[model samples]
Target: MNVAENEIKSVMDKYRKFAVYGLSPDPTKPSHYVPLYMRDHGWEMVGTYPKPHEANGFTIYKSLTEIPKEYRKFIDVFRASEKIPEVVDEAIALGGVEVLWLQLGIHHAAAEAKAEKAGIKVVSNRCLIIEHKKWF
Candidate 1:
């Protein structure tokens, strides 16, 4: 299972927990289904948002700072491409965030650079669910 050029998947291979940013509470939302699908493939997924609340039977975090220390390995983002820079910053602040995965159709050069510069691997414009499926 080769990750992209920038994303090596080392942290992904070593970690079981995943923090999903921009996760939608609504089941009909694409952000909701994509991570949900990845969860079905044996990946532990945590839903995150910009609000401190609850959604889909899970607690919503206002930012990556809200994530717990133990589960900070992979940070998957589903927001607009333009917002990725902020996500990258959040990932760096959280520490131990290995993979900075932007959801399908989302990409930003600056964000990728930020993550890479901070030693976090980058995977933009890719779907974790789809990648898992293809790998298996």
Candidate 2:
């Protein structure tokens, strides 16, 4: 399999739950809609927002550490590219992160490398909805 395919397979085989970092309350935003879509399609989703809030019935946490350990295994990030290193650091610190998924238009090479070095699979600049549709 190609690298992307392999990564997707690995993530699919391992994690049923995911945490969205920077999940927005706005329905029009992909950050809001993508996780909702995933939830509807049977992927358990929790989120980390800047503040404690609810977005479309999903609980939003204030930090990665606040998310349950099982949900922390797959983190799909929606923060800006420059914000990724901090997110990476948080994921590394929190530990047990199996995959770090950077949403479409977000990419940080150094952060991705750091995540990979820490043994976390990194997928960047990809839409989770698009990929899920394509793969399954």
Q: Number of the top candidate by lDDT?
A: 2
* TM-score per candidate, chains pooled: 0.84, 0.93
- Model 1 pairs whose backbones collide: none
Global local distance difference test of model 2: 0.86
Clashing pairs in 2: none
Candidate 1 — which residues are off by over 4 angstroms?
1-12, 52-54
Q: Write the per-residue lDDT of candidate 2 for residues 1-136, one digit (tens) a residue.
A: 1137556755765677989998999999999999988888789989988877778889888998888998999899999999999999989988899888899999988988988989988888888889888777
The number of residue pairs in model 2 that clash at the backbone is 0
